[model samples]
Structure formats: C-alpha cells, structure tokens
Target: MIPLSGDIGNAKGIIRENLGTVETRRGTTTLKRGFAHMLKNGVVMDVTTVEQAQIAEDAGAVAVMVLDKLPADVRKAGGVARTASIRIIEEIMDSTTIPVMAKCRIGHVYEAQVLDATGVDMIDESEVLTPADEFHHIWKWDFTTPFVNGARNLGEALRRIEEGAAMIRTKGEPGTGNVAEAVIHIKNVNTELRRIKSVYDAGDEQDLISLARELKVSYGLVEETASLGRLPVVNFAAGGISTPADAAYLMTLGCDGIFVGSGIFKSDDAKERAQAVVLATTFWEDPLKVKEAQKMVDERQSMLGLDTKNLELRMQERGSTA
Candidate 1:
C-alpha cells in the first residue's frame, strides 16, 4: 500500500506545478479554472464517510467528494436527496489530506453557500441531488471556491461556463452502475464540438451566431468553445462509471478526468475497485496498463448496474438547462 503521507505530499507538488503561485489567488476565474486543471488525468470519487474518504485517498484518487448517500442508495431510497451533512463533511475534511469536495443540490444557493463556508476545496452543483429550483442553477461566480457542473451537451456546458462554473462533467444517469448514458452524453458533446470547430474553421460567423441562439447560450461563448475545439473548462466524465475499462474508455472519449459515484463504495470490492480505476485513468492511453488494472478487480464485485431508460428519476435532466 502507498503511504498516505507520501502520496498527499506528492499531490501537493503536482498542484503547485499545475497552478503557479500567482494563480493560487482566490476567487478569480483563472484561479477557479486553474484548480480544476490540477485534477486532470485523475479520479474524483464520491465518499459518504471518513473511512471511505481515506480509502479514496489511499487508492490514489485526486480528490474525494462527500455525499450523504451513494448515488445507488439515493436512487433506491427515492426521497429528496440533499447535500451531505456539515458535520460529516467537516469530519472527512479533517481526516483526509487531499482536497475535499461536496455536492449541493442544483439551484440551492444556500446549500452552496454552506459548502463554500465549510472550506471545501471545491463544490459540485450537482444534479445527482434533488433540484432546489426548477429553472435555474446557482451563480457560481459569487463564490471563491471553484464549482463543477453537469452538462449533457455543448449548449448546457457553455451556459454553465457562462454562469461561472470552473469545470464541467457529463451528467450520466447517476446511481446506475451502467455507463451507457455517460457514453451517449459524451458523444453528443463531442459531435457538437466537432460541428462548431468546423464552422469556426470555415469562418462562418452567421452560422456560429445561429448555433449560439439555437443552444440558448451567448454567441461569444459558442465562438470561444469553437476556437478551443473543446469546453472552456476541464470536462470530467461522471455517473455510472463502474470499472477500470469504463474509466479508460471515457479518457479515450476526451474527458480530462473521471468521477466515480456509487461505482466504488457500493461495489463488493471497494478498495480494489478504487485502486483499479485510478490506475486505469492514469494509463488510459496504454492498453497493457489498462488491462493490468482491469485484472486487479473482479467484474462480479461491481455494483449491480441500472438501465438508464428504466430509471425512475433521470438525475441528468434535473437543472440541465440554464
């Protein structure tokens, strides 16, 4: 097992190298975005307790997101899911040396405020929780901490970025161990990205403006995304990812990182699965390495996956629009 102290120190060095001293200043867009950049090629695992957070860290997760219940449990319980308790969040924060993150219900400004005030390294304005407001999401610019939001397509992503989200993740049907919905979402984003890139390359300003209007986002944001040939912020694949192969496949699909929700702790082999995912994400470009990582865990131990089409609650659609 990797020594906890050594791994954390190494993580700090990587953060420093990715985010220079000046860029570390709080609240600025660059700083907020820079924070997400530091987590590229990494895994962010959802954890409900200090022990799970420790396992996440020891398994080499770049960060741990505290939640009241795993996505699977939330799905099964069928109630108003909310942000994790402050007491639990604080306890996990105290226990783990790595950066800690927590989720707030979509559009719940107070929940976000509470999380920001708790001094979490980042806040996920997540659709996995019940939406507090039907039509809108929290304005992330108001907070000093970086925010990550879920997106189903380029339009939703750009709108979230316009609202000051520092990072974006595909809102795969959370709680479902099945990765199909996540795959579809990423492909949708990629297809749009390519179309816009082609439009920008052709210098069709009118068509680009039309696309912006069609997407219900600002033209400038569309143009910016087109120019970059990607989302303006780091994009991670979240929800439904359950195995080493799942993590590696998303990396191949252009995600900057991976977010495993119920995929870890709900599995029959949480520790082995967590380590395998981290390894697969880091070496996704290498088939041999991914194969080795896959061999570390048993497929039967994975969480029983749900079919996205049959889900009672479509978590991805909650607060998807601006």
Candidate 2:
C-alpha cells in the first residue's frame, strides 16, 4: 500500500523542491525531455477530482492528468472544451505524490501559459479539447514547462517535436473505449520509421532530403530520427485504452508508456481497472503477469466502446497540419 495522505503530502513537498530546480533549468531541451524520460514504462491516468487523483496515485500510476471532465463526458457534451479549472488542478497537485499533468486545447498558447504558471509538472497540448486554433500549435520552446503533444504519424510527430514538444503520444480517437484507432496509429508511425531508417541505411542523403520536404520537417531532424531509428524523444500510446489487455498490447508495440483517459474513472470498477492497467503496462512482456492483471477486472464493468467509423467528432483530426 502507498503512504497515508499526510506522509504523501510531505513527500510531495520534497519532490516539489527538486522540481523547482528542474523548472529553473527549463528551455534546456535535455532537462525538459529528461523529465518525461523519468516516467517511461509507467501509466499516466486522467482524473477530474482530488478523489480520482488519489485513487490513481494509490494504484501506482506514475502521474495523474487533471481534467475538467473525463473524455467521454466532454465528447458527449459538445461545447467549447477548454482547460480544467485551476483550483481543481492545484488541489490534485497538492493531494497526489505523483506528477500532475493537465491538458490545454490544441494551439491555445494562453491556456498553456496559464497551466505552466499554475506549476503543473507537464502540459498536454491536446486534441481532446476543442481546437483553439485551426492552423497552429503552441511554440513549446518558449515555455519552461515540458509539453506533450499527440500525433498520428511520423510527420506529425516530427512537426510537434520541431515546435518543442518534449514528448509525443498517438492521437488515437479519445473518449471511445475501442483501441483500434490507437493500434492503427502506432503501426502507421512504425511503418514510417522503418521507411526512413531504410533510406538512411542506403546512404541516400538526397532521398532523405526529399523525404524531409515531403514530411515538412527540418532535414536535420529527419536525419537524426533516421539514425536513431525511432522518435528522438519518448513516445506513449493514448486514447481509448480501456482494458489491461489494451494497455499490454500497446506496450508490445514499443510505446514508452500508457495514458488512460475514460478507461479508469468512467468504468464501473474504476479502482480495480486502474490497478490492473498499471500492472499490465509494467509487466507487458510477461504473459502470466498480464493474465493475472486481466483477471482483476470484469469485461462487463468496462465502458461501452464507441465505433471509430461512426464518430461525429474525430478529435485526432482537429489540429493536425500533416
């Protein structure tokens, strides 16, 4: 079991002191990216209230993302979606020992600024919220706080990176309980990475340059990615990840971590589901362990999945330029 609330608060205070040093070192890509690197292979769960945040931390989540509402509720109640309330975010941060993250609408600079000023550990320039700008995203390099952005392919990932995203997640169809779109996205990014790797291996600089033009990203960034044979920074899987199996499957696909939105709090068995997903994510390579985690939750208790082919709002398409 985790520590009591009083102990947790004391530990979080120590963590904040260390984080203050990290924040001072902001604008340094190494420090910004390193902050994300520390959370690799962990689960980051979406939460709306202090109670949900505590549940997530106790379930062994590496972090909790504060939101005004769960993704499902946001999609069901279609209006202008924006950032979560500052009071709620601060309250969660105070309550949880784990890192606290919050989302801002895609291309919303001021929202990101407000979140940063509020001292969140990370900011997600998310497509889940309504787009505040159609043709642009926040220039993340200017901020001291790290930002994570969503992408569907290599080009989009590279573009977000160029614009200063410290981390990248697949822009899977959020709010739905189906993992099909997330699967499709990771596969797409892998295919594109393989294509670039092969081109670089063939020593075709000219071809790489042409591909960079096609991707609309800097040639140097493309070359670096090709040499590395993967994204330069950590990449996670997000959206529609509901079950333990879903979490494990994405881990097998080379994601650095997992993000659970409506998958936890929206389910009938939130606490059990949260713990099970974390277990599966951590032991994804061990089939027996994954099976044990899968047994912790019942399928009937899961959220009703939405079909991606029949969605009215495709959140992933909102602020994508490539």
Candidate 3:
C-alpha cells in the first residue's frame, strides 16, 4: 500500500535538507536508507558473474547481490567465505543499470570497508559468510555505505537497527530451499510487534521499558516501533525463497520485498525462474497473476530443496547473541 516511488523521493528530499551535502555521514546514511526504500515491492537476486547479472536485470530484478558463491555452494564449500572478488563486483556494476550489493562477513569491518571503497550500492553484513568475529558485528554506523542485516526476531532486528542498519531481512535459513523458516521468522516479528502495540495502546509505559530491556534496544526505539506497529525501516524477506509462490507468500505476509539467493541460478531454468519470481513479487496480491507466474517455471526445475531441520549449518543463528 505504500507508494514506493513517492515515499523514496520524499525521503531523499528530507536527506538533502537535513545534511546539505550527500558526502557527510548523516547525508550518506539518509541517502543509503532512501535508496533502499526505492527497491520496495521488488526482488533482489544473487548473481556471481556479469552474465548472470545481466540475466537478472533482464528478468526485472530491481537490484542484484554480487557473491562469489551462491548460498548452496557456500554451505557445500565449508570454509572462510569472504566477500566476492572486487573484479566480479565491479563487472556486475558495469553491466547492470540497477543497484549492485555485496556481502561482507559478520563483524568483518575491513571487508565492509573494502566493499564500501568499491562503491557498492549497498553492503550486507551477512551471516551466510563464516563469521569473522564471534562476538561482535561490524559497527555499521561507522561506515558511509548503508548496511542491511538479518534478524530472526524483533530483538535482533532492533539491535541491528540501533547499529545503524538501513534495512532488515528475516534471517530465514539460507542455502535451504525451504520457505518454512522464513515464514516462522516473519510471523515471530509480526507477533512480537502486535504484543508491543497492545502494551503501548494500554498506556503501560513500564511494560514498554521492560520490553526495551528484554530486547536490549533503546526505549525511544521501542516506543517508536510500538507506535508504528512495525520496523521503522524497510523489512524484506530473504534466505530460503525458491519459487514464485514462496515470493508471493512473504509479500502477502507484509514484507516490503524479497531476496532470492541460490534460488534462480541453482534451478534448472535460471532465466525463467528469475522472471517468474519478479512477476510474483510485483503482483503478489493477485492470485491469478501469482498462478501465471508459477506457471512460468517448471516445478521439476526448482532447486533441490533441503530440509531446514536436516541442515548442518544454520546461517540465521549467527547473530543471535548480538
């Protein structure tokens, strides 16, 4: 229901007025968040090469995430998964008109710095990579580029938001083509929000303070979240989405958009699956349109799904302590 274009433009206007220059810390933060807002109600696909990036762009992706290995491969390779090669990222940026994003290891500030220097449109402090620091995440507020972090619940989401994340995605079990985890996460966040709103509506200020303590976030942020009834920033669905129905299912659950990693390229028909996912995301409320999108991909060609319960590694659990 949010008018994506108009809202983003207005956010940009506010950013311009607040900082007077786009190069300042506040200005860059505002610009980054505003830019993310522009990608609402769209799909961001993961691509490893220039050709794949082109395929995703042609398939109508609003943005592309550049990665050396897809989530499935990352799970298979089992090593220190670092950022994508600079050359690959640069090539993708050169090839696509849409925004290009890259992932940095959780808590790896230098990797983030290097990606920022490469001029990526956005940086994901991703758990998909083997974490660089077991205890801390990158201090996102220290960087000029906007960052997106994953959350399994409202506490994690708020912690990342407090750390200056411009956007948040549900930390659904990545690398598994199972949507069940994603569904659980979104539901958890929504449920927690409703509870917070009820407390706020009942004028239980002390309970709100208790909630702030439980979530380990600022009282002001807790208050704002309760008042708004959702995260202040754009929230997208990510991780296990592998089909048109999966994409639309999350959209209907109130996510702003989706991130499909290892879903398209890992499938038998990458191009067709990419386009189908985009169409589903755009017209998620229309069941007929969703069906048409589903018809675009052969069920036999979808990525072989892995049961979340059987997976050896759970990327979503990486930042639980933070």
Q: Spell out the clash pairs found in candidate 3.
A: none
The parts of candidate 2 lying over 4 Å away from their true place are 1-24
Tell me each candidate's TM-score: 0.92, 0.92, 0.92
Order the numbered candidates by lDDT, best leading: 2, 3, 1
The positional error of residue 50 in candidate 3, measured at the CA in angstroms, is: 0.4
In order, candidate lDDTs are 0.88, 0.89, 0.88
Tens digits of per-residue lDDT, candidate 1, 1-322, equal: 1111101111111232226545443466666778898999999999999999999999999999999999999999997999999999999999999899999998999998899889999999998888999988887767778889999998898888877788899999999998898999999999999999999999999999999898898887788788878777889999899999999999999999999999999999999999999999999999999999999999889888877887678988888766
Cα-lDDT of candidate 3: 0.88
Q: Which 10-residue window of candidate 1 scores lowest in summed lDDT?
A: 2-11
Poorly placed runs, candidate 1 (over 4 Å): 1-25
> Model 3: residues >4 Å from true position, as ranges?
1-28
Model 2 lDDT tens row, 64-121:
9999989999999999889999999999988888999999998889999899889999
| Number of backbone clashes in candidate 2 | 0
lDDT of 1 at 293: 97
